[model samples]
Target: MGTSWSARIVDAPPDSAMAIEAVLNRVIAQMSNWEADSAISRFNAAPVGKWMALPADMMTVLRAGLYMARLSGGAFDPAVGRLVARWGFGPDGLTGLSAAPNHPAPWTAIEVEGDRARRTADVTLDFSGIAKGFAVDAVAMALHDLGATHFLVEIGGELRGQGVKPDLQPWWVDVEAPPGLFLPTLRIALCGLSVATSGDYRNFREVDGTRLSHSIDPKTGAPIANDVASVTVLHESAMLADAWATAIMILGQDRGMALATRQGIAACLMQRTASGGQEYMTPALAAMLE
Candidate 1:
């Protein structure tokens, strides 16, 4: 949670800003890996095999994380926190060394029973991929409860829009692209929709001259190595969009586009090439464009 958030709403109540802030704070307290006392940190610190009771919000995020892990066949694992830390992407900071996971696909070992959850292995839970998107959806719901029908919510780069603007226009936003890429700009009307993008250009580290992306491949127990520059996903639920974007990015263009087509996911994948960059749009996204 090292970024900013904003909300653009029509007829916002005086107290709506405070309510939005409260919702964002609540999500941070539950999932921020930077916070030592966050619920996710507590779960990561908890002894393996011990069931820990979690707050409803934390439980919800964890459930969704595990679901995406399974659905993506470990490509979008929430239990890759140890790998994230070793790669200098987490609170552990950068150390010039690498390590492997004790278990392959550690997410499969996570078990959630009602409001309680536990891990069978020494896996660290990180919600970095999906938490921000969920926060956007949460803020949107808060706005609705505040009697605002038309609003747009954004956290970091993920965004969601509901209803329309004062001018009766849908909230239109241009999806992000990697710099220096001469790709066609893609825009979408975020009416009851959410969009999330994962890219190697954003958060990265240089190790002895080689740039390493923040995206850790759960299968490899290391940073992903591919030409995939970024992947964008559009969904009704920002949480799903965020997770899917990360998953598809890890899968690369060929496999990722195939997966997107099979699952009927609206996705756009961009890859770095010798000249510049290449783009691929899945049938789901192409249908939307048409």
Candidate 2:
């Protein structure tokens, strides 16, 4: 919600843009951590051990986040919201944080029942990793409801594509190599798939003379230190792709690639190298390119 969004739909009504923006605005109201009045912010600011009613969409994303936290063995935790705030990535906007606390809360602190949720401990939830992908899917659904048969929805680089262009060509997205690394723009076809990328090259800081990623590993409650430049995942659901990309980014090169292979997911990971950069792809991702 802090970033921009764009959508392109074939033979769309002129008001399609407005419709997409309205949908995005709804998503922002529901889940934006930057917005003080957002549902997530309200939940985060709520007192501990209080059950709060959440919208269906918010509940869905929360469930997905919890699933990812378990699937990644705490590597991708929603309970790290306080860690994000302490590290100056939260709404407070205080930069140059000297230190960070360990995961402020555990996922187990959360209890969800139907449309109501509560924290057993001093837990906070953040959806920074998965909200945009969910918003993209929301836009896709909105467009379809508006009678769009072919479209591409993107928010902050996360993308979802359905059908094809009027010319019958699939939506093409250009994947750039990480900054300070020289490589050609890799064009990826986005047809019947959703794609998301988690990169360490952007949104980072220099702590103790070492460049560190802004993405905190929930297991450590610290900025990630790894050779991974970026990990891109392609899935049928953009929200799942978004969560998987963050998980793989936190897992680093070897383990991430191993999980990608074991799970049989489409993932392309690039790691930084002294010479330049090296690419790693799971069998599914390689097959997609082929």
Candidate 3:
């Protein structure tokens, strides 16, 4: 939550507004790496045999991430931390390699024990998939507790909306496709719903003529090279939506859509064409667009 976050509530009381701001501030403090004592920073520093009891916010995110990994057949894995770190996405700098380490995936080697998690493999846990969405949900709950009935919450690109504006309409959101592509905007009415988007556009580096994305495939321990460029998931919980979006992206277009359909999750995938054009959602995902 060190990144930007916004909320809109209609006709909120002054005290409620202040409480909402306080909640956002707390989220930023807990999630930001700039703060030395942030939960994420502490988790990163935690060593083996040291059982760290995660806060409720971080616990919710880890649980959601694990659930998504199971749901996606380990396609969406938080155990790619070592690979992420080697790529210079973590607190450490890059390993000067064009690709990730050629090791087996780490998710299968990690273990979760109640509020404490451990990794037997030489990997760390990167919660980037679910942290933003969890923060959004947490802040939204805080606002709701402060007596704000209708509002929208967003952390980074993940979003959650509840009830409606005073005018009696659900919060509307526009889903954008990746760059250098043309596609119709997805208009969603968020009524007690959460949505999350995961894409390769913003987080990628180029080595030679090939482009490598930050999101890794746990099975291969490598960056995913697929036709799909982005995936958006809509679900009851923001954390689940966020993790699922990343998992779907890792699973690639065909298998990703199949998994989504099997799980009855609404998903949208934006694909890049060889001609530099864009293809819209898959049939299963397009059905959810309506």
Candidate 4:
């Protein structure tokens, strides 16, 4: 996770902050693309057709990533590692050329069995879409283990919260809307759910005078050419929300809204309109506002 993280706990012990920091850093060591020795990096560096043993948690995330790829119909994929590197959003950002590869890999080529996974093809794996959310979850678990019943953990703006403050109020969070969206902010009462927001306003590059989003449409092996301003997802698991948010954003406004409705997903999608922006929300998310 190449972002800032924060943990706020009610009645947290003196050493709880340091403990939570250590826990988050440990997660980074396991999944960080920037770390050459990270478990995920090792898996990526492994030759094609070679099985790499992974930790149980990493395997769980790999399974989840595959599930999301299927659910989104390839709109969101972890196998876009090569595209990520080419678009200058990977471990070596900015210096890399921003051009799509001729033979980029797809997520379907990966094989997973128990705590081991291998690529049947020459596909590289990138976990940036979901790793931060996993780190947030880990921090929340660490806080719970430290006897913190009321806590909120956020990594790169994806967050999870449990329990109410001592004053009996829920942990309130302000979800940021992209610059062009009509609504600049949406507030939520966090009790036992995670929130993840994905947008093109941030984490993108202006490639050759064309603003290219870091989010690549695996189907085309190129940056998605959609007018979606931003999308936010709420779920019990931040990792799920994180991956889904990215997928739904790539699907564009109409398709994303339809999928969110058909699946009963609590999602908010904003589309870039001529004047400013328009938005949509699933029924569950509407209820949250009320």
Which candidate ranks first by lDDT, i.e. highest?
A: 1
lDDT by residue (tens digit), candidate 4, 1-290 = 65787777888967888888787777777777899998889998999999889986777778889999888888878888988887778888767565565653379889998778998876788888888877778788878887889988888889998999788899899977687566768889889999999988888877668779888888788778798878999999999999989989888887877887788789998878788887789888998788
Model 2 C-alpha lDDT per residue in residues 162-250, reported as the tens digit of each score: 99988999998888888866766667889889999999876776767887787887767777888788889999999999999998999
Model 2 bad stretches (over 4 Å): 95-105
Query: Model 2 Cα displacement at 230 (Å)?
Result: 0.7
Ten contiguous residues with the weakest lDDT in model 1: 95-104
- Using lDDT as the measure, name the better of candidate 1 and candidate 2: 1
Instruction: Give a tens-digit lDDT track for model 3, residues 53-112.
Output: 776666666677777777788888776777776666665556665666454656665566
- Write down the lDDT that model 3 would get: 0.76
Q: What is every candidate's alpha-carbon RMSD to the true fold?
A: 1.1, 1.7, 2.6, 1.8
Judged by lDDT against the true structure, how good is candidate 2?
Answer: 0.85
Write down the TM-score for model 1. 0.97
TM, every model: 0.97, 0.94, 0.88, 0.94
2 against 4, candidate with superior lDDT:
2
**Candidate models: Cα lDDT each:** 0.90, 0.85, 0.76, 0.83
Error of 4 at 50 (Å): 0.6
> What's the residue-level lDDT of 247 in candidate 2?
89
How well is each residue in 135-207 modelled by candidate 1, as lDDT tens digits? 9989988888889998999999999999999999899999766997889889999999999999988899887
Q: Using alpha carbons, what is the TM-score of model 2?
A: 0.94
